[model samples]
Target: MKIIPQLLFVIAIVIFGYFFSKRVIRIRKNIQIGRKEDRSDQPAKRFRNMLLIAFGQKKMFKKPLPAVLHLFIYVGFLVINLEVLEFIIDGLLGTHRIFAPYLGGFYTFCLNFFEFLALAVVISCLVFLFRRNILKIPRFWQREMTSWPRLDANLILIIEILLMAAIFTMNATDQILQTRGAGYTATGRFFLSAQLIPLFEGASTAQLILGERVAWWAHIIGILGFAVYVTYSKHLHIFMAFPNTYYGNLNAPGQMWNMPEITNEVKIMLGAAGAEQNQVEAPARFGAKDVADLSRFNIMNAYACTECGRCTAECPANITGKKLSPRKIMMDVRDRVEEIGSSNSDEDGKSLLGDYITKEEIFACTSCNACVEACPVNIDPLSIILQLRRYTAMEESSSPADWNNMFSNIETNFAPWKFAASDRFNWSKE
Candidate 1:
């Protein structure tokens, strides 16, 4: 029945809305549980950053081959979704090609363009799958990649391919039905899908209609399912990248964000004028031990991570086979956040610093900022690493002996070297 299809479409819409909202609320709650810090400064610069880094994907061009392939997939996915809008309208009204009569030739042009992009998506996905599974790119096979991450990546690519195939099938069958005078709208020929016509030739009108309906439902349902799955996948970066880039650190790479209390303490110790008046109280804890102690941006950084391995690949510590993997750091944070979100209590006697990330990995970092520089979405894993290191040294007093000695010298003298400030120019005298 015509009404039956519309009824099914409405039920599917309601189901998608419910699950999508549930995941969004959980994510929002998890992100909000972290410490708050203002990142609203310089609206103009942030907007430009979002456009270039997130939308234009400027940072992905470091490696040209994968960059071009990724561009095809990314641009294709975004552009071809324009057809989904029409699909939605048609499903709701129980009509076929609702926009065909209204837009006429333009509708045909749009479908042709979508088909071209769909083909591009299929090609790009295949290349990526080959690179990941066959070529065995080292980054894709990292320690943190594990089973789920690898499978998630492969699944997303396969799904994209199948969804694109469904579109071609639907269009090809629709064109056949139109020619057969089965009350189908004549939207002219689609360039890419028209080539697929031969595949469905010699089939009866009933069979053709069945094929089109199946593809029609599959494509839309696949999209809805994808929207929900992304929240739980590393593909969350698809949406989070925009906001992450917009609020990315605008300060110089070398200029670390100091603790406010530490800054105030330093000024007071230096006896700067009015320093006592501006003195701030110390925080309950020195640095982050859990996700709750981290800032909202840090949690968001975890969520925004593409798990692309660029951060770990560029990390000097990881390159030298130290325990630190910047990608893992982000993944650990996200996992911990998810654990906290799902549990009854935020405290589980297991903290992020000790349980998820180890002291070895934290201490292995060279503080070189390579990971920060390499992240496409501007996620600063070094920031989280430093926070964990701070907790180890300040709260736990567990810094290595070599670092302790350096800290003692800095406290007494003016530098890491064990010499007086007044004799700092003695090297020049020698």
Candidate 2:
């Protein structure tokens, strides 16, 4: 029977690893399907950005109340997970409170700290749920947030609350067992957990043990399950945020990434470089007709988007009732990426261009920087929109009549207006 329990623990670990590894590999593969670009310049600056923006949640602080509330979940979840290492060890070795004897008082200090975080996480989650469900904040009801995105947010908060509750219950029952002179070993009373001691007071040894066991199992297992679930959920930003911020565009908002293929062609045409020097193997396509046509960073940005609607809320186009929603653009990129990654979804020959994101939506963009400035995670929705817009205009030659005339004027007269430079004096005389 002892051997059987050990075998089961090994099997559970293997199952979790298998699923987690598969999801990670799939995401990596999907990201790699995109075109490559060099974002390797300035490693030190990138590191600082990752630390300050992603780790510090600097942008979130602009909104004080929600930022503080979110900080609780961010810090609490991250800090509490350190205890998971001990939980993993204990589970494999069938040891209860494995670090109690080794660390002595320090273990108690750590547990107390974790208890405080756990309590904060629970309270924060409750408040988040209330803000989303009961209060029904306006930004939360944006068009992009109507269905799964809304439910996904609520579900994650509820799961976090339950996970925190299990941790508290586990510690509470362990404290009871310790005071009764049970063999559970004394790790010292955790402050927040101690408050719940009365609930299990006077319970039989068997009942207390069962409660402790259930809570312990629930927390560890729930954490493992959540680890797998994040890869599939919008909550993936938790893991992707660091690297996404590091590779994020550091250019001023108005400085767009020029299409290198187009740039090289232009250099050749202008005689700035000899055809041989400018000559490279032509790409199969230009701009972004699909997720694969986009750069790797853009696909990663899609995965990193928190879908907080800040982008949409700040978008001039969205506010004006245009077809464009910057938030929806990111969400559509992620959804189409998912479809492309799944078997046969790409077989229909439809893509992000006309199928998911419409031409009208792409045309509505005024090249304003509000969405980029408002994104807390530095997600570049405009880049995706412009890429799609480029494909629509340049590759497909489908620009609206007005835009086509503007393009013609710029190409012929070297300006957006149709006129000869010599003829400018006629207007000046008037």
Return the top candidate by TM-score: 1
Regions of model 2 farther than 4 Å from truth: 267-273, 425-430
- Worst ten-residue run, lDDT, model 1? 271-280
**Candidate 2 TM-score over all chains jointly:** 0.95
In candidate 2, position 418 carries an lDDT of 90
For candidate 1, give the lDDT of residue 148. Answer: 98
Q: What is the lDDT of residue 195 in candidate 1?
A: 91
What is model 1's C-alpha RMSD? 1.4
**Clashing residue pairs for model 1:** none
lDDT of 2 by residue, 118-141 (tens): 888888889888988899887788
For model 1, the local distance difference test gives 0.92
